[model samples]
Target chain A: MRSVLPVLTIVAFILGFWTLAVVPMNIHLAADQAARGDMVVEPDDARARQEVGAFALALGNPAVIPMTYTLDRPRLPGPQQVVVELWNTVFAVAPTSNRSLIYHGWVTLSATLLGFGMGTALGIALAVGIVFSRTMDLSVMPWAIASQTIPILALAPMIIVVMGALGIQGLLPKAIISAYLSFFPVVVGMVKGLRSPDAMQLDLLRTYSAGPAQGFWKLRLPASVPYLFASLKIGISASLVGAIVGELPTGARAGFGARMLVGDQYGQPLVTWAALFAAAITAAALVGLFAALERVTLKRMGMAA
Target chain B: MVSVDGNPQGLEHSAKTARSAVISASSVDLTFQTNDGPVHALKDVSLDIEKGDFVSFIGPSGCGKTTFLRCIAGLETPTGGALSVNGMTPDEARRARAYGYVFQAAGLYPWRTIGGNVKLPLEIMGYSKAEQEARVRRVLELVDLAGFARKYPWQLSGGMQQRASIARALAFDADILLMDEPFGALDEIVRDHLNEQLLQLWARTEKTIGFVTHSIPEAVYLSTKIVVMSPRPGRIADVIESTLPRERPLDIRDSPEFIAIAHRVRDGLRAGHADD
Candidate 1:
């Protein structure tokens, strides 16, 4: 109850503001339609009336003001309209059907999972390389950091075009872009974790006559668990964003990003807002799952997560 | 006062009277080349440690005692001179698992439980599971932590944690035990109790032990031989042989013989400072 109260209050506040915003955003069209209807003194000249602005006209007419919530094509959909659209798209169609939000969600989810796996592997490998070799530490670490500085927006289209040129149409190109965005965090995190063992601990390993492989397995790798899971959380969210971004530029016919693009092009704000909320919720669920895993792993390792 | 080269002869002659020498160092020196300049950590240090001897290196801070111990464990290499463990190079002896080392801090892996920490060296050396379990049990009992095997290192008191570290070193059953200020962090009462326990453990196992400490009473109470060292280019200031008997209780610290040996150690430390 303590945590939920603040969330509820914030949601109610946003909904109230959104309901008020709908009036102003759709007021012009509502007024124009009302002016051309039976209430108008003239048919063609009603919208061109001299005295009042559209907002003022809508405010004065009760019927016109109410039309803002009931518009078929609104600039910004009301909260109730978005909720209804979400309910219909998620439940009304078969899960495998193209029209269902579940089908689109699975498409995005597949790419995100695949990208996250590849990114995690690449990041850990690079981190190991950076930790053990001074050459890689001096050379590759700077490049890894520099790679993230390039805007993903600018990079995503280029990756899509390059993969399209190579005749790879779906999934792989998006996963590659996702891998590119996610690997940096894991690299930085694992480097710190691998080096977490202090001088005395290293000396202990030496006294045991343990080799580098033994040192890593017994000390560095186990030491890096908390860090690895922390990085994975950040990487997974970035992977989801990369998948959505990949869908935007490639003119995708399916997925959450495609649904948003289609709704935007057709001026159906309800579809777009519903898909946006679904993407957010999916990202939250992914982060939550990893958090659960981190708690278990760290606790088992005798580390307080 | 004996010169550095003159003292090793007397210690060797004494060591020859009872048991064979296990560790012999002659003019061993280590100078760390940091970015600022070369700083000498150990200089012209010579010593002979016999088998079954409880040898303690007592010194002020920056004394080469810890450095010399690390060199024995093959964690650091000396820049000059000869040091040997069990008739081989320090590195060779390390590879052969001839000694077990306890650091100044507990240094237990937090991810591992007390039993797991004790089993670590045995695991690395490829001991069978049953053997590893038996050894861990025996050492835990040796440290009086037999019931706390499943507890994490952080859950234990600092004194218990250090004992757990000692248990870890004892797990492998090596002939020599190298401990660097294992109880230096504990309270005085705890330190005294651990000292008594350590002496008992040493008596039972008869392991050749090399210990480092800053406390003169600790050195006098626990050692068959004491090597007093000084800082700023660390070197041995004095070597004192204890005439006290093997069996020592907590009250033995107040004996005149103990005080006489401690005073000699203090004079050696003063002499090292006078040279500086």
Candidate 2:
């Protein structure tokens, strides 16, 4: 409850800024719409309005300000318009409908989850190999780091085209892109976590005559949990971004990315804004879920303060 | 073969004078090759620790006191000379689980309870769950940390955490216990109390103990034999045998005999510094 006030204050500030920006951004459309109703508009010409700076045109036609929030196809949709569209798409329509945000969210989310699982498993396996073997440490780690530097945007389309040529289509290609994006963070974090034990701790294990397998299970694996969750949160968000970008190039018919592209092509900014907000919310929920799990696990293990 | 007959003062093992050497190092040398140059961490370091003897190695930093202890525990390889534990090579003795080592820090796993941390060695040694629990219980009680078995290390005081570490070392019931300044991080008051408890523990366990420290009183009060070492090509400068009886009290430091031994250790340390 104490935290609610500060969060609400921040949300209100962003909404207020958005409300103010709407008039300038949609001034040309609002002016055209107002002129149809015989209302006063700057220059009384739609073509002339586009040449004018949005802020200058908005200042010139103050009377059209009230109509900016109500434009049918706003250049930048107002916050309230996005909220209404979100409500209609998310709850007003059946989940199976192509127009429903839930349907699109589910499509992206399933891909994200599949990719996240594969990436996490692969990352941990690679990290263990690197930690235990000098060859993997020397050979794979540099490549893993170098792989991340190749822009995911440039790589996503290439991956889709190659995978498509191989007769793989739809979710698998998108999931592979997500796995590529997420695996690096997990690999780096797990390596650090698995190697976190100090020299003294390792020496203590050596004194016990513990085998490498015992050392890993009794010391390294348990030690890496906190670090694993930290990377997992970052990986999930990156995975979502990867899935959305993956959709952009493949011309996918359904998913948040498809909804965004469709909205842009069809001049429906409200649909794009709604999909954008839904994706942000999804990312937040996934990260929150991991954080809660981390707390519970660390608490049980007596690692948490 | 270097004989153990040179150190006349270190022969004060009374009734246990006939006991065989559990750990014997003759001309044990270790030189660490580094980017800067070769570091003579230990040089011709020789000592014999008889069974059930409480031996303390006291020296300043870089004196190879801890390094010698590490060599004994088979955590470090000697580049030269011969060292053995229980008539076997240090590596062989380690594989046989002949000793338990306690480090400077507690090094308790945050993810484990005190009991779980204590049970770590037992678990690795393939002890049954029931036996692990039993040993954990016994060691925790031995360290006066019986009530803290379920608590995490962070919840305890520094003193209590150190005790928990001691309990962990004792859990495996090994014949030899090697400690490298285990109480170096604790407060002086806690140090004194722990020192008393340690002597009692040594009496109860009858384990061959090798301790490293920088304090004179701690060395003289706790050790049956004190090996005073020097830095820079680290080697033993003096080996002093304590004349004190087996039964010792905390106030024994105030006794004339304890002070005399402490003074000799202090002189040995200064002489080591002067040589460099």
Candidate 3:
């Protein structure tokens, strides 16, 4: 409480100052649009231009949106309007209506869940393969890293096009993208964690006449829990990235990414920002859930969280 | 699993019903293939360990003390030698799980509780679950770690971890116990305390022990017979019989007899490693 107090106050102060600066400008712009008899002003139409224009014109920058423009051309949505719109979408429409926030969120959430699961499984299997084989370490590890070097931005469109040609339309490309992104960290982390049991620990197991499988199940796998969870956190976040990427290919008509795209087309910056925040919040919650699960499970197994 | 105290296993390299040496190493030589060259770790050494003797090996670094222990435990096979435990080869003896090895660093599995670590050998050796639990409890008591059975290794102090390791060794009741500097990392106070406890424990169990250490006082204090070793060809220099009594306490160090033995061990160590 004490640590966050001053920070909260500073944040509140910045927010207050920002509202003061922008709300009046929004009102002036709305007033000017009203004066011009125009009904709707695209949020992006004059955004960059207005800033430069205000600087250039210098006088009666009273062209400030809130105080001067017509009602439709309110230079920007005030923070309160954005919040109200966001709140309505989240609390009101999301929980109700057939075409709702939950409905759209489910589309992205399904992709994320499927992707995360596939990625984690594949990652663990690959890690096991890499750790157990010298040839795999020399070969597969480098290739896994190389696969990620190409930006997801480039990969997503190519995946969609290729996948569409193959008559594999839905879910597969998104999952593959997420798995592609998520598996690298899991493989790297699990390999390091699995191999963390040094020569002495291996020798100890050998002294027991433990077989290779026995040694792994009894020692190495348990030792790798912390690393696994750490990788899972990374993997889950990457799953969100893949879900959004899946949206970029054909400008998806649903999901948060789709919402943002629609908002951009309609010059609704407030809606776009709202969707981006939702996606971020969803990702944080997913990661947090995994963290809680890790703590409970690994702690029971006597591993450090 | 019954105690063989009445007819204690003795040392004899001959054909007889369980009458031969419990452990025999004749003309043993070990060479590790290193990047530099073949490290001549042990050279043409021979020794026999009786079933109920406190034997300690004192040597400099790279003097094959650990290698010898490993060989006996079947962790390392001798390059050239006829090594046997109860007339069987080291590999066969290991298949039978004939020895309990305690490494220098305790080597307790960090994920296991102290009691669970002690139970590991018994579990591997196919003890009944109840018997394993009983034996784990009994050994934890022997090492004075009865209350710490539930605690993980990292929770314990270094001395306590070592004692827990000793409990692990003792838990399975193996015929032989091989210790490689088991108390080497502890300070004087904990080492002395553990030494006394170990002597008492030795008196009680009478298990044949092959201990490896570099410290002169540690050599003189716990050993009944000390094998001094030299490096750079790694062979036994001398095997001196310690004249101390079986019941040694912490106060035994102040005694003139203990000091004389300490001096002799010091000289033996110097004579042993001086060539290196």
Say which candidate scores most in DockQ.
Answer: 2
Find the candidate with the highest lDDT and give its number: 2
As a whole number from 0 to 100, the lDDT of residue B128 in candidate 1 is 100
lDDT of model 1, residue B92: 99
Model 1 chain B lowest lDDT segment of ten: B1-10
Instruction: Indicate whether candidate 1 or candidate 2 has the larger DockQ.
Output: 2
Per-residue lDDT of model 2, residues A1-305, tens digit only: 59899999999999999899998888888888888897877787778878899899888988888899988799888888998999999999999999999999999999999999989999999999999999999999999989999999999999999999999998999999899999989999999999999999898998889999999999999999989999999999999999999999878999999999999889888888999999999999999999999999999887785
In candidate 1, which residue pairs get closer than 3 Å at backbone N, Cα or C atoms, i.e. clash? none
How would the docking of model 3 be graded?
acceptable
**What tens digits encode model 1's per-residue C-alpha lDDT throughout A94-210?**
998887899999999899999989999999999999999999999999899999999998999999999899999789988888899899889999999999999989989989999
- The sequence of per-residue lDDT tens digits that candidate 3 reaches over residues A1-305 is 47689989997997788666564555535434544564443333444435544423223343444443223224455566666666778878746453465766778888888888999999999999998899998999889989989989988889888988999866777777888888888999999989988777787766667777877887789888889999999999999889878886677777777887877788876777677777888998999899899988777766753
Runs of candidate 2 with Cα error greater than 4 angstroms are A1-9, B1-19
Pairwise lDDT winner, candidates 1 and 2:
2
Better of 1 and 3 by TM-score: 1
DockQ of candidate 2 (2 decimals): 0.75
Worst 10 residues of 2 chain A by lDDT: A40-49
Clashes of each: 0, 0, 26
Off by over 4 Å in 1: A1-20, A33-67, B1-19
